[model samples]
Target chain A: EPEVTQTPSHQVTQMGQEVILRCVPISNHLYFYWYRQILGQKVEFLVSFYNNEISEKSEIFDDQFSVERPDGSNFTLKIRSTKLEDSAMYFCARQGGTEAFFGQGTRLTVV
Target chain B: SQQGEEDPQALSIQEGENATMNCSYKTSINNLQWYRQNSGRGLVHLILIRSNEREKHSGRLRVTLDTSKKSSSLLITASRAADTASYFCATARTNAGKSTFGDGTTLTVKP
Candidate 1:
């Protein structure tokens, strides 16, 4: 089975610093998404992108967060300024048919 | 908010035994998907069942969907130590590309 790949398995940044998480989804997928899971918390949806635009986003995805499929190959999520609460495991997923395939995830630690 | 809620927050079973987890959701969904996450790792797609379908089977795993009751169940036969992980059910709102995940059920299979 094909799999999504996320860069920088672990990231550590200071609070108020900027960070960018990158993802390479399965080649033929048209739909992409980003989700985060805090320690011992439920997975939260951040944003969904389709056809080069955002289709839906959650309240957690505020002005500090942004996603783009630059170069038509990689999907990147940028956090303008990091916060301690921003520390979590960020996962990238892609939808092909009815199911979604996820990446290994990038563990971000904002100190 | 989350659409699906998994029951029995946690479960522990001996290897070779069967493990079952249930999920309840609000609103109608085109399909429901099950995923597994091992500790701090990323999620792995397990199976998917459509609302119109009653049941689906993949290897030792069986998934049942009851659209009328707005619920679904996953059964893993002959569970093994490696089956220990957190299981989550996901659903997408009508016409939306992103999926909403449940709180998830933690399962531990003792060898």
Candidate 2:
């Protein structure tokens, strides 16, 4: 079965540095999304991308956050300046039908 | 928030026992999906029940959606020790491809 793949299983970055989490969703999938799960907290939606544009985003997805489908296969989420609270597991998902497949996730740790 | 909230944050069951998790959402949804995540792992799509569907089953897993009550239940019958994981319910609203997830229910099946 084809599955979403994310790069850098774990990452540790400085508080003020930048970080880019990359994901390669299923090739044929159209809708892509980014969500984050804080330790001991619920998963929170960050943004949804479709047709090379952002469909929707949450308050947490402020100016510091940006998503790009720079290529046909890569979907990347970038944080301009990482904050301590930004540390969490970031998941990338793709939806071709009602069911969405998620990647293994990139664990972001900002110290 | 358009998120689904799952009940019984945690559960413990013996192998071969059945486990049931409930989810309630605050808004109308086009579809509801159940996902499983093992410790420190990515989310896996389990099942999806459309708003018009009342019940759905996949192998030993059963899901029932009650749109009138905005609630859904996921039943894992004859669960095995490997079934231990955190189950989450996600809601997708009409015209909104983004999915909002709940805190999830942690189930530990003891062998």
Candidate 3:
């Protein structure tokens, strides 16, 4: 079965540095999404993308966050300036319709 | 803010036993989905139940939805040691393209 894939399974960055998380969703999927989970917390939606634009975003996806489909296969989330609270497991997901598939996630750690 | 809340933050069951988890949501939803995640990995789609559908089953996994009460239940029968994971319930609200996830119930199936 084809699955979503993410790069840099784990990352450690300085508090004020910028970091970009990358994902390659399933080839035929049209809807892409980003979600995050603080340690021991519920998964929280960050943003959803479709038709080359953001469909919706959560409050957590504030000024520091931006998402782009820079290429046909790559969906990227960039955080302009990281913070300690930004450390979490970031997941990329794709939806064909009712069912969605998620990548293994990238664990971001801020120092 | 339209998130699902699952019951029993943790559960421990022996192999060959059945495990059941429940989730309640605060808003009307278009669909409800169940996902499983190992310790630090991405979420694996387990099953999806539409708002109009009352129940769904896949393999040994069974899911029931009561939209009137805005609640759902997932039952995993004849569990195995490998079934140990965190289970989450996600809700896609009506007319909302984004999904909200629950805190998740951690199940530990002992051998």
Instruction: Point to the candidate with the largest DockQ.
Output: 2
lDDT of 1 by residue, B1-111 (tens): 358999879999999999999999988898898999999999999998887899999999999999999999999999999999999999876534577889999999999
Residues A56-97 of candidate 2 have per-residue lDDT tens digits of: 899999999999999878999999989999999999988867
Q: Rank the candidates by DockQ, best first.
A: 2, 1, 3
- After aligning candidate 2 to the native by TM-score, how far in Å is the CA of B25 from where it should be? 0.6
Off by over 4 Å in 2: none
Interface RMSD of 2: 1.6
- Please provide, for model 3 over B40-105, each residue's C-alpha lDDT reduced to its tens digit, 9 standing for 90 to 100: 888999999999999999999999999999999999999999999999999997433677899899
lDDT of 3 at A41: 88
The deviation in Å at residue B85 for candidate 2 is 0.7
Off by over 4 Å in 1: none
**Model 2 pairs whose backbones collide:** none
Q: Relative to the unseen true structure, what is the C-alpha lDDT of residue B5 in candidate 3, on a scale of 0 to 100?
A: 90
lDDT tens digits, residue span A68-106, model 3: 998778999999889999999999988867778888999
**Candidate 2 chain B: 10-residue stretch with minimal lDDT:** B94-103
Question: TM-score of candidate 3 restricted to chain B?
Answer: 0.95
Go through the candidates in order and give each one's C-alpha lDDT: 0.91, 0.92, 0.91
TM-score of chain A of 2: 0.96
lDDT of 1 by residue, A35-109 (tens): 999988889999999988998899999999999999888999999889999999999988877678899999999
Interface-residue RMSD per candidate?
1.5, 1.6, 1.8
